[model samples]
Target: MAGGARASSSSARREVAFRRATEADAYELARRMFLSGERVDMQALATELGISRATLHRWVQTREALLDRVLGDLADEYFTRARRAATGAPDDVIVAVAEGVARATIASGAISGFVRREPELALRLMLRDDASVRRVLVGRLRGVLQDVLPDEAEGLEGFAAATVQLGLLLVWPTLVAGDEPSGERVAEICRALLAGARAGELSGGR
Candidate 1:
């Protein structure tokens, strides 16, 4: 009965795997595929989930929308981790978090792989007005700035925007030229901006 027992165990394993794939929602499956450096193909995803293409389309609308969700979720996770890991004065904390996120993004194989594979689509999705990924990241930074620099409340939005822009600039070389991105430079530039803002140089002596 040893052969019978082996067959039963194998069947159980397949059942468990099938159950996991069926249980995961569309977004979760998409995110898992994205993080695995696989191209998130809606048809393949639907087939794996045992769902119809119509159902998948109704759930995510478009591939771009699904990718936006995946990227936004990753950005939120990275930002949260960076914020938790950062320690220092308020300004320093902000800089650390920004740099940490930048470094993590640069090092992410999934992110870099996607960018290299589809530069135009990646740029369009990330830089579009109302892009949810950028909004999520900027919102997180804005919340932190509001907490740490309440006195500069009037300029915090602008400051947070500038910080995100700087991060994009720092990562651009890697995304475009296959060169390494510099988190240290990001921190240095952010520090300078913070110093200028604190000195009332950025907002005309606020």
Candidate 2:
């Protein structure tokens, strides 16, 4: 029974790897089709994968679902790797977070570009309360602020974190200017907001 269990585990790993390989191929073809400014035809992708369209349909189900899988997975990978790449110094966490987010925003051009190509999808995803981007922002960013504002204990840090994430969308051009976005500027404003909030210095508040 022990030997059988080990064999089953090994076989499971192999099957996982093979399934990932197949998905990678399909993802690659979809990306290329998306990049070419042509509609992603799952049928062509299935042909490339040596599977029928119905089989591809069984695998990914729909074009939107496949695109969602590809883009969402890419975001996760980028966030994971970039977060580790951060220097993680006490004072510099804000800067690291900003750069990390900037990288993500730029990397998300793939999805954003796709959104531009299809207005209806753009309206669905980018406009009118996108739960996807919100979830993505809140997930990775919780850590960045948690590390950055240790002094502002009692969840002030969490507020700052939320502000930073949402602020990027609200005032993006000013917040992130050119190749070298002003992480310092963002940090300064965030720090000030936190400080002011604590001291009851804000003008339009309860």
Which lDDT value does model 2 have at 22?
65
Error of 1 at 149 (Å): 2.0
- Superposition error at 96 for model 1 (Å): 0.2
Clashing residue pairs, candidate 1?
none
Encode model 1's per-residue lDDT on 1-206: one tens digit a residue: 33453455345434545664442367776776677677889998777677789888887889998898888888899999999999988888899999999888888888888888888778776776567767888889878887777777565446666667667766854576788889998898888877766665663220
After TM-score superposition, the amount by which residue 44's alpha carbon in candidate 2 deviates from its true location, in angstroms, is: 2.4
Return the TM-score for candidate 1, rounded to 2 decimals: 0.83
| Alpha-carbon lDDT of model 1 | 0.76
Local accuracy of candidate 2 as per-residue lDDT tens digits, 15-115:
44455336556666675555444466777667556667887787788887776655555555656775777775644554465456555655444444565
**Candidate 2: worst 10 consecutive residues by lDDT?**
171-180
TM-score winner: 1
Off by over 4 Å in 1: 1-24, 199-206
